[model samples]
Target chain A: MTRPNLQVALDHSDLPSAIKDVTNVGDIVDIIEVGTILILQAGDQAVKCIRAMYPDKKIVADTKCADAGGTVAENVQKAGADWTTVICCATIPTMKAAAEKIEEVQVELYGDWTYEQAQLWLDAGISQVIYHQSRDALFAGETWGEKDLTKVQKLIDMGFRVSVTGGLDVETLKLFKGMPVYTFITGRGITAAENPAQAATDFLAEIKRIWGE
Target chain B: MTRPNLQVALDHSDLPSAIKDVTNVGDIVDIIEVGTILILQAGDQAVKCIRAMYPDKKIVADTKCADAGGTVAENVQKAGADWTTVICCATIPTMKAAAEKIEEVQVELYGDWTYEQAQLWLDAGISQVIYHQSRDALFAGETWGEKDLTKVQKLIDMGFRVSVTGGLDVETLKLFKGMPVYTFITGRGITAAENPAQAATDFLAEIKRIWGE
Candidate 1:
């Protein structure tokens, strides 16, 4: 089994702060996600700036695009994003347009999905899926429990490169053992930490321990 | 009944072209929408440029925010947008977070809904509603023959600022007469025209004739 990658989600309100944090921990992170908030806050320039700063690192623009897929895909590609995300709920025409553009750039779907939505996305030729673990439940004394592992396995079985996200921390990382995840994405866990580099190093250590990398 | 404002939606893929077009017809356009494509393409720089170029115009960032409303609102507001859009399908928390950001930033919802959704938005403190017409049907030899003005009237009666969009042209503009529309948002009808300024002027003239402004 391929080892899962670590993607630091830069979902901050400002580009300078996000860049500063990424600069501190870019060495440990495999993929850098310009999260939805970052994309909305700074637009494509955020992607461009990050791409310039880390010339070889993979940068994914978390657009969460629901409509006008071709336009969004083309724009992000021009901004130096290696991958752009579309919402699973987007219309078929929009998906088709996005897929066509994906020939030139990578397109991933970002949303929690039922079995049917996952099947539909596969049918639409989307290979990447972002599975969000709801923050509300996590913050309200709920644990990162069994439900996610099952969902992750199901999506992996369906031939998707699944990315897991939502309030991920050291405790929750243990729950993902033996899961065929493509990338593990965490936001506040790293950016909000007192020592971002150490936090990233901790996350990398945990991943290596889980996967024996 | 209030005269419908003429909103020119700049959905261009580049800032220079969008700025050029807006400057050409900025005097006649009531609301300048830095469309989703433009925002995603150029980032908040697009909003800042438009606001700087057209200081008196009401600049709207069509962020189409799906989640994390406060972050999206603050970023765009920092970019100098007068209003920001939230997807109608967004959770209540997202909407409330957007509303809490700034009094000047109006939240616009887009979706096909019964009157119940309008009431829900009103109760939720959303002041703007977007009504979408199908562009495919409009372009495929279909007319506004089976028009429904009652929905627009109903939304207006509920005290929402309603905007009508989707391939809006002179032929279709006639059907909206007597409907309580707050704004008519035109994209391709103006932006794709051979002479965009003239096209904007013609649209404004038709709107004046209909509303006797």
Candidate 2:
């Protein structure tokens, strides 16, 4: 099986801090996510500025569109994002609209969703889905468990390039030891670390350790 | 019943055109929406710029938060938006997070939602909701019909300040003649018109004609 990729979710509320994290660890990570908070606070220019700095790296504009998917997709594509996201609850037409505009569109799994919905997304030509443990859920004291693993496994089995996110840390990497995760997305776990560079490196090292060279 | 507020939705892809529409009709319209498209393309500054231009006008940042509600609400609130939107599909916790941060939060009604769900949002302390005839659904030949009116009426009965939107035009306002809509949101109906100022005046005239001066 191919190794999973390490993606740093740059969820900084400001541009300079996001840029600092990217400057510190952009080379070691497989993808740089200009996260939703950054885009909301700093604007689409966050994607443009990061794109300018890392011409060759994959960048995600986590716009998490719920509607006007086509317009949102086109906007991020122009800003140079390689991938963008739509909420899983967005309409099938919304998903189709987004998939038509961008090279890759991931359905961000939030709240409650069904495999039936994932099938429709795949049918609509979207192949990537992010299984999230949302911030509020984390704040409410939820944790990654067998139930999440079962859903992720089911999606992978159903032909999705599944990426997992939400407060993931290096220790959490050990949970999916044998699984073929497409990508592992970490935000504060890496960006808010005392040494972001080392944090990023540690995440990559753990991935390599678990999934092998 | 009180007259419904006329809100102009600036769903333009760029800032200049959005600014132009605001400049032309900012005085006539009751609210200015920094539409999801504008926020995605131009960033949250769209809210700040409009707030600066018309300090007295109510500004709605249509952020449509699916998660990270607190962060998204805080971002738009700081950018000078008087209100922000979270999708109807968002979790109750997500809705609560957003409501806690902003003075006013409107749940943007999208695909397949229930009064049961609306109750959850209302219970979470969000009193405003935008009932949308989504653009994709419109492109697929959907229209504002009895079912939509019924749902809007029910939400109003349940204590929500119901705001209706999507592809709304001057003539369409005639349909809700006697309905106690808290607000009527129009986008292309005004902003994309040959004369936005005249269009705005026409909308106000229609609102007055329907619900009286």
Candidate 3:
């Protein structure tokens, strides 16, 4: 199994703050996410600026686009995003429209999804799936848990590059052991830390230790 | 029954173009929507610019916020939006956060929602529920049809203000014959017309004719 890559989610409201935080940890992170909040707050300028600043890093614009797929896809691609996300709940026609628009960029579908819905997205030719742990469940004393692992493994078996996110931390990362996850995304755990770079390094080290990278 | 108010959805990518279009029909439109595309393209600047240009107009920022509702609500409200939209698919925690942050602004929710979901939003203190008509459905030769009316009335009886949209035109306005729709939103029909002001006036005229306002 391939070792999971680290994606640091930038959920800040301003570009300068995001740049400052991410720049400090850019080397350790394999992917940089313009989180849904950051995208809505700063718009395409945030994506363009980040792309300009770090030409080598893989950037995903988490538009969480549920409709008007063609327009959203076209706009984000023009702004220099390498990947854009669409929700699993979006109509197949909308998803298909988005896919057609971003033939040059990677399209990821969120797997905070039902088994039936996941099958629908994969059938629609979406290349990736994002397994989101519910924030409510996390706050209600749930760990990554066995059910999540089973679901992740099921998705991986279905030929999708799976991404795991939601309340991920050093402790929770262990729960993903033996899963064929393409990437592990963490937002507040790293970006909200006093020393973002060190936090990123720690996350990277944990992933390496777990996966023997 | 309250006569449906005509709303013009300005979904352009640039603020200047949007302002020019809205200025032409500002006198006729009852509500002006800073559409999701515009909000994503220009950020809060789009909302602020429109508010500055037309102080009396009721502006709805179609942020379609799926998460981080507090940040979106606060930012859009500060930008002078009278209302902001959140996706119904967003977590309940996100909805609660948005409601808490809304001081005097209305929160609108959209998606393939049921009456139960509308009830949940109302209980969460959301002000309005939007029943979006999908463009792809229209493209696939489906009219607004009968199902929408039943859904609209069901939501209205539940004390929720229902906004109906999806390529609405002069003929489509007739479909809501006896429906208690609070708002009738038209985008390309008005904004993309040869004479936007006249098109908007005609749309409102048709609504008045149908609703006997």
Candidate 4:
């Protein structure tokens, strides 16, 4: 199995703070996610600025698009995002439109979604999926457990490059000890840490320790 | 008994085009929507710029938020949007977070939503709901018909200040002749017209003809 990539989600509500977090840890991270909140606050400039700063880094614009898939995907592509996200709730047509416009589109698992939907997304030419534990769900004390793992495993088995996100920390890394997670996305796990660079290094170390370098 | 508001959707891919459309019909329209595509391309700067130009206009940032509701809502609010949208697929917790942070939150009806969900939105303190016929759906030949009207009527009966959108034209306005629509959101119907100002005027005139002044 290939080693999992480490993606840092820059979910800060401001561009300067997000940029600061990236400046501290950008070198260590494999992918930079200009998070939804940051995008909403700062606009596509968040993606443009980050893309300008890290020319070779894989940038994910976490737009969480629900409709106008082609337009949204095309816009982010123009802004320099390598990949963008669409909510699972969006229709197959939306997915098809997005997939047609961008390099790659990830289906963000949110609210009620099904494995059947994942199949359709693949059929629509999207191979990336992000299994998310939402912030509110996390705030309500939900944690990653067997059920989430089961779904992730199922998605992987179905040929998705499955990524995991939402309030992830180093300790949480141990949960997926032997699983072939495509990427482990961390936001506050690193950005909110006292030392973001050290936090990123620790996350990378954890990924290597669990999945083997 | 109130006349429905005429809200122009600035769904252009860039700020300049959207601004030009707004400039053409801004004074006559009751709401200026910084559309999802524009927001995706330009970011909150779209809202901020529109707000700067039309300081007194009620700007709607069509964020179509799927999660991190409070952050998205608050960010748009700070950017001078009077309203922001949350997708129906978002959890009640998400809607509550948005409603708590903003003056008002509108649930943008997309795929697989129910009156039960609308009640939950109301319970979460959201009163506005935008019934969307997605662009993809329109492309697939989905038209506004009886089923959609029934749902819109049901939502109105349930006490939501319902707004309708999706490929709205002058003739489509006649369909909601007797309904109490809170707003009629038009995009290309006006913006893409040869005379955007004339199209906006025609919409206003049609609203008066159907719903009465």
lDDT of each: 0.76, 0.89, 0.78, 0.89
Q: List candidate 4 segments past 4 Å from native.
A: none
Off by over 4 Å in 3: A103-113, A134-143, B103-112
Best by TM-score: 2
TM-score for chain A, candidates 1 onward in order:
0.91, 0.98, 0.91, 0.98
Q: Which one wins by DockQ: 1 or 3?
A: 3
lDDT of 2 by residue, B95-199 (tens): 889888888999987666778888888787889999888898888889989988988889999999999998899889988877899999999899788998999
lDDT tens readout by residue for model 1, A102-142: 44223333232357766766787777887775443344445
Candidate 2 clashing pairs? none
Per-residue alpha-carbon lDDT of model 4 for B173-207, expressed as tens digits?
99997899999999999999999999999999999
- For residues A16-68, what per-residue lDDT tens digits would candidate 4 score against the true structure? 98988899999999999999888877778899999999999999999989888
- Residue A40's lDDT within candidate 4 is 73
Q: Which residues of candidate 2, in runs, are more than 4 Å off? A: none
Rank by TM-score, descending?
2, 4, 3, 1
Total clashing residue pairs per candidate?
Answer: 1, 0, 0, 1
Mind sharing the TM-score for model 1?
A: 0.86
Write the candidate numbers in order of decreasing DockQ.
4, 2, 3, 1
Query: What is the iRMS for every candidate structure?
Result: 3.7, 1.4, 3.0, 1.3
- TM-score for candidate 4, residues paired by index: 0.96
How many Å off is the CA of B158 in candidate 2? 2.0
- In model 4, what is the error at residue B120, expressed in angstroms? 1.7
